[model samples]
Target: MTTLVAIALVSCDGPTDAGAPDAERFEPSLTGSAHVPYSTSETVALLDEHTACTIDTYETKIDCVDSSGATVGRFGDKGEGPGEFLSPARVIRGPDGLIGFSDSSRRRFFVFTREGELVAEVPLHMLSIFVPISFSETTVLGAYTDGVGRAFFSAYMGDVMAAAEISLSTGDVVREWKPASVPEFPECEHGLPYYGFPAVGGAGDDTWVFMGCGPGGDTTMLRAPRYVAESPSDRDVEEYGDGLREFRRRIGADPDVSASVREFSETPRLYFLLRGQETFDGQGRLWISTRRGRMESSFIDVYDGVELVGTVEVRDRMIDFDLFDGTLAVLVERQVGPDDSDGVPDRGIDWYDLGEF
Candidate 1:
């Protein structure tokens, strides 16, 4: 079934004020232990209380491990064929306890058993920005953009986005909802049109969305059937084309830097300043990664709905992270120069026993 919801996206000071009265703080262990190298895809999910699965986009395969940190198996490979993934964008454990991989380049959803066995690979009509928040055999409920055809919806400023529920067998959007309506851009002129790209994470049938364009704290977090969040990218506002009409009037159609960034800064959020991502705990609480400043580690904010419940300071630069069943799997960004086998740097997936949060 499809549900239509309306929400207003608001700018938050969550990350800016980690010392708030409601925020619980901690610094987790970041030692080099239980490292699964080259399997640090942007997403991770748990198959069981101990078994965690993630995509090695570097190797173009599924990487799973048991409770003892042993290689369960490396399933799938680089191919356009079934059970093969051309570009595995996101990986999640389904409600039925199966591993699901979203291959954006191939536009197919691959389903597999927790034991690394392939079940089915269904096609999807969505693009890279449309992230599957909730997955099942029949349909995939994706959060974030629904193809506004804008030059850039996020750091180039944003457009309010509508979430879609697509069919698995047919690869069609069967249902959808506008996740949020931004009465105003999350950060007006400063981080408004920067660093924030949409981030999606989930546990089982539940999915959570975060819009982090710049270093700005909590933009908006949304979920289906709906959430009170900052709309992804919107077309309803007067600043269509991210204020290009006025920008061209002022700067001669130069770039998509909204209209105000010229008077402020000419750029959105730089990649060097922000490498942001998100995930969810077993209880379906949201874990979003943000940085207070350019540093070695990441500061993660845990939100239960709109309430800031807890926060964690990691030891390494976190590329992406996920939490389920009291276990946390983080894709840590470690530079090892280069790899001849692949053109990317060496990556690692660090597993932690963060029991009972």
Candidate 2:
């Protein structure tokens, strides 16, 4: 059985005073603790008041840690069997004390109990990437995409690529909704070929969809009509492309500076600034992290539904985060040492109290 739900349109023009207040500063109460030595980990989720879950991308497993930073138990391995994962992309905790794991490589969804017991395994088709927005004993709601495609870079910017409601018992998609047509910009040569999909987060019965490309590339909580403003003049785009090439060269990513510059120059002005990850707090506030500039920390935008609440700045680069019980669990990259040989930097999970906010 399949059903389609019309995408609900909401206002995106929030109040002018939505910026973070000067008096409000969110400092990490705990920093760089040697307890959780990060490796190829990308995400952190708070399971309970004292328990934190960290996903190890390299190990392909999830680590459960207590408040004292002690490893309580570990679940998952690299396999095709139950409780195993091939490419674990996202891990989310459900309201019923079940942990949902979306494995893009295997194209399957695995559910586990809080105590690390394998409960359910469902094979998913169509969507290559899955981010669970809401889950129950029988149903799972989330936003998904068929990976990167030209249609994803449409100009409308308001449409979600795809969304679904899956049945846990039958491993079937009970409902699916997709955009009718993706608007395109014929003049712009650059199409978002990478992961340019919108960010989706949900709490309780509410789900929040955040499109990456808005006016000025600012993060917007609701999907509004595509901005039809004038594209950056060709000369301006070229200048900005040159700057981007230089930055890439300095970072040692682009060795052929000339080719990089040419590539960027031919591309369209997709976004003024890149938006990062987003998560919904326990109190139903949507927190989105947007990069200020190259190699800069993230400014988190808080929203109550489509209304802008305020912003919070984090000093470190936020890879991914999770919120539980009014606590913000942030996974941040550790600073590299001069003597560090390996290119991969260590990561740590920092906790912040969002109770007062």
Candidate 3:
């Protein structure tokens, strides 16, 4: 039997009419200028106390900025070179203080020091691209897909994906583990045109993975599961396979139509949703963006380990966000006028002062 844990939900509706509430709401502290245009598909990571790095998908480089919001340095280019990136997927600060990035097009992973020096580049030819979680002198940790095609759709059916530790030198998998499961809605269909995938991040030896979907009162109890990576025996993997098979059976999806629908969901189209990106802070707190109502406002659920700490509803539609030190930075998108302009709207990055929430 599966046990569901009830998490207490706290709503911080940012300063009501009562002349500012006791809780501090998220307010814009910094905005990205034209020099460092924020990309809706890019991933941001804090390099240190004063610098934050983002994979500029449009510019095809890593943009590093200081606390003053000035472009300190930009590295990499659009080419098939050592430091260059072709179709860079995500950028993350590894556990070794080095910056690691994955390029799905090139089927390779690159590691660079904070000083913009490329140290290692390894070719990884896998069915699904794995997001780097952490790194050491010899190995790199990441969340990888074990099965192909329909297996990637397991998250939609409430199954825990696979993660592994790979050798940085030989490009070989060292060890793998499957985390615990969270609440999943097997009947939920893809209402939006484009859907968001599950994200994985690491802090020290611990790794966290989560999947988010739009707000629905009927599925309010659906929260992303966080698990500590552990070594498992052959029986463990076999049991997980059984659970996954059962989940797929419960969804009652035709195998052929399921593959077709998954392909269609990848088409580039305007998609609006209540849930956005998920990440972990330096303090190991899980921050997940979600919407509660049909309004434009969105809320972020902050969890310390597995316990729900607090929730804050922001006024803007959060596309993605990252936490560094005590500050919260978000990439937001707003609807623009002129119906002839298609679905492309104005987007920007906003830094927030998360004061004592």
Candidate 4:
């Protein structure tokens, strides 16, 4: 038997008041012009070119870093191993100092002790799942009716994100909820439009807010409607999915959009609008990597809710970003200076502190 609980959200103590300017709360200037010292001699290195995994490629295991840039811990390589990871989708630290990450491509969840010891692995139900990046320390007494499940015992999945509770002692999924298949966003059905990521939020309360993005992608700029699925129940979800499919068919059948729609459909990434990358702090904040601005240069935007607030700049094209423990960590590629004797990239990890912003 399953029971659904309705959840209500209280505004975060985040900077969202009338007197508080968005700039004051989320300052882009903190990252601009000024270059903060992120790496130091005391920084620890975890997984690098020498860590014995397939490290020749750029986007391979080069993505993981500690939240504070103080050290890099051991997350295994591409092959099968106790701590191994193949295309890690997301990583987070639970309250108990256990590090958890989901391998979307591998359909597994990994848990490790604070010292980088792998102790638990949980198999998942689907391969297309995008694992939720947030962690709650408390136990989940109920699954909220809203898109975001309520209670501390819950975790989320992506794209078709779901909220579920897994037993910490047994690694078993206690209760689960999945998004019923709705039609793809309508605008993409019509034009050769692109879509990236939908915005999502999880408050301290059980309220999870979700809004879809329409016809926006790595290159095109389009004003998209923001349709939200507030704290919806199982019955409400069924109805929403029906409405979504009808909208998709309507746009797909349009004669004017037939050609572009066909092309867009051919490229799954562009047509499906999988932003390719998504990040959330589990604290009601989200960031998406989208090509909606410049095709050649991908620009990342940060949001508190449905509102567009700021941008994350990767000036060197040699870095990526991740949200960790309420902070944003930037993985800057280790570069060799002209005077260095060894040609290998400098092995150092650094992360930006967003809380200070």
lDDT at residue 127 of model 4 (Cα atoms): 25
Q: Higher-TM-score candidate among 2 and 3?
A: 2
Cα lDDT, model 3, residue 15: 22
For each candidate in turn, the TM-score is 0.65, 0.67, 0.61, 0.48
Query: lDDT per prediction?
Result: 0.53, 0.54, 0.52, 0.37
The best candidate by lDDT is 2
Clash count of each predicted structure: 16, 0, 0, 10
Among these predicted structures, which one has the highest TM-score? 2
After TM-score superposition, the amount by which residue 20's alpha carbon in candidate 3 deviates from its true location, in angstroms, is: 20
RMSD of candidates 1 onward, in order: 9.5, 8.0, 11.6, 13.7
Q: Over the stretch 1-357, how does candidate 3's per-residue lDDT look in tens digits?
A: 122222212221122223322223344344332224545353666665456677666677777776676776678778997777777756766655677877766878888876678888887757776767557777777665554334434333323445667787878778766533343323333322112223344333333333333332333333332111122323223333443454455457443344444443442211122222466665666676643321255556666654556665554555556676667765555544586267455544455566554
Comparing candidate 1 with candidate 4, which one achieves the higher TM-score?
1
Misplaced by over 4 Å in model 2 are 1-28, 31-41, 147-159, 179-276, 293-297, 305-307, 338-343
Query: Residue 39 in model 4: shift from native, Å?
Result: 21
Number of the candidate with higher TM-score, 1 or 3: 1
Candidate 4, 147-173: lDDT as tens digits: 212111121112333456555445456
**lDDT digits (tens) for residues 1-357 of candidate 1:** 222122222333223353456567776543223456564255666666566777765577777776566787777778887687776766777767888777656777777886667877777765545666558778777655544334223424444445677777777778755433233334544343322222344332222233433232333433211111233212113223434453354335555645553433433322121222455555656666553321355566676765667767665556566666656666665543445355444555666666455
Ten-residue region with minimum lDDT total, candidate 1? 224-233
**C-alpha lDDT (0 to 100) for residue 2 of candidate 1:** 25
